[model samples]
Target: MSTQINTIPASEAVRSAEERIASYDWQEFATELSGYGCAVLPKILTPEECKEIAALYPHEEHFRSHIHMARHGFGKGEYRYFKYPLPDLIGGLRTALYPHLADVANEWNARMGIDQRYPAEHKDFLKQCHDAGQTRPTPLLLQYVPGDFNCLHQDLYGDLAFPLQIAFLLSEPGEDFTGGEFVLTEQRPRMQSRAEVVPLRQGDAVAFAVHNRPVQGTKGNYRVNLRHGVSRVRSGQRHTVGIIFHDAK
Candidate 1:
C-alpha cells in the first residue's frame, strides 16, 4: 500500500551535520581499526533527519513490489530482511541523504585496515566500478526488520560493488525491539565462523568492508567476511538503512 511522504526541511540537518563531521576527527578510529576496519560517526543525522527518512518509508517502498531474495533461514513465515530502495530528493535527497554517507566512505577509504577495495580493484575502468547492463546505475537499499533478520553472508552482487557498507539505524533499536545484534566475523581461513556481536543504538551506525579486510590482489583476498545475523526481535519492529556505493554501478 502506498503511503504519504512528508518532506521536512532536511537540508538544515545536512548542513549542521556537515559542520560537525568536519570538526570531528576520526584519527583514533583510524588508528584503532587499521587492519580490522571500523568507524562510528555519531549523530550524523539529527533526530529530525532520521524522522523524515522514516516518514518516507511506505511512500518510497519498492520491496513491496518485488521480492528480492532474503534470509528467511528460520522458516517460511520468518522474514530475514526487507531491503528496498530510497528515493532521491533534490534539496531533500542530495543534501539530506548523501553527504553523511559520502563522508563515512571517504574517511574509511583513507584508513589502512579498511581498504577502498572496489576502487582499487577496478582502476582499469574510468571509474571504480563499471555499470554495464544494470538499468538503475546507483541503487540504494533500506532494510526493514520488523522482526526480520539477515543471516551472515558476504554481499556479493556480481562485480558492481561497494567495498564497505554502513548501516543507518532509524529506530530506537533495542528499546523499540530486541535481539537485533549485528555480529561481525573476526578471524578467517582456518575458522570461518567466529563472529563478535555488537549491539547498535538508534542513530548509531556500523561500517565495514564486504570481506573482513583488504586483499592484496586486484580481485580479492576475501577477508572471510562477516558471518552475521540478527538474534531475533521478539518484541518490537526494526528499521535500518544500508547505502552501498559503486563507481556508477
Candidate 2:
C-alpha cells in the first residue's frame, strides 16, 4: 500500500502572494502613507489563508522565541518571533512587498534629509541587516484576548531599520473579536501628537512607518515620529501577523 501526502509547493505559494500583492494600487497606498503615515490593503489575504497563518501560532517548531508582553512591559498579550526559515506564506509576502515599500522608503529618506536608502530587493536588504549583526528574523505572530492590549511602540530592532512594516488581521472583527482596533500616533515637532484608529477586518493589512516619516511643512519636509499599537480587546480572541523587514541584533 502507498500513502498519499498533500502539500502545496513553496514556489506556488510565493507566486500566489506576489500575484495578490500586484493586484493592489500601490501608488495610492504610497500616497496615503505619505499623507497619513499609514495605509490599508484590504483583503490582501483570504479568510482561509489568514486562519492558516494564525493557526501556526501554537506550534513551537515554527517560532524562535516566545514573548510574554506583560513580562517585558510590552502589553497584556503574548507573541512569538519566527525563526530563520519563515513559513512560506509569510516569507513570500515579505519578499513580494519589499520592493514597492523600498521605493517609498527611499523617497521618505530623501524628503527627511536622511542619507540612508534601502536596496531594491528584500534579500539584498536582509544581507545589509545581517552584516550589521542583525541576523535574527523579526516576523512575528501576536495573540490577544479580552482585556489584553499592546503598548504604543516602534519595532526597531537595530541601527538598521526598515521605515515601514505591515500587520495583517487574522480574525474577524465582530465575530472573532471586538474592540481591538489598530492604532497609530504621530508626534509632530513642537505640536500635539495626533492619534489615528485604523479599522481593519479579517485578512486586511496595514502598512505604516516604523519610527519617522516626512510630513510636508510650509518651508520644507519635516519629520514626524510614529508609533503603533493595538487597543484593548473587549471580547473574544484576536490574532495578527506582523511583517517587519529588518532583522534583529
List per-prediction Cα lDDT, in the order shown: 0.48, 0.93
TM-scores of the candidates are: 0.64, 0.97
User: Distance from true position, residue 55, model 1, in Å?
Assistant: 2.7
- Off by more than 4 A, model 2: 1-6
Clashing residue pairs in all predictions, respectively, total: 4, 0
Error of 2 at 227 (Å): 0.7
Stretches of candidate 1 off by over 4 Å are 1-17, 60-131, 134-147, 214-224, 247-249
- RMSD of each predicted structure: 6.3, 2.8
RMSD (CA, Å), candidate 2 to true, equals: 2.8
Error of 1 at 181 (Å): 1.1
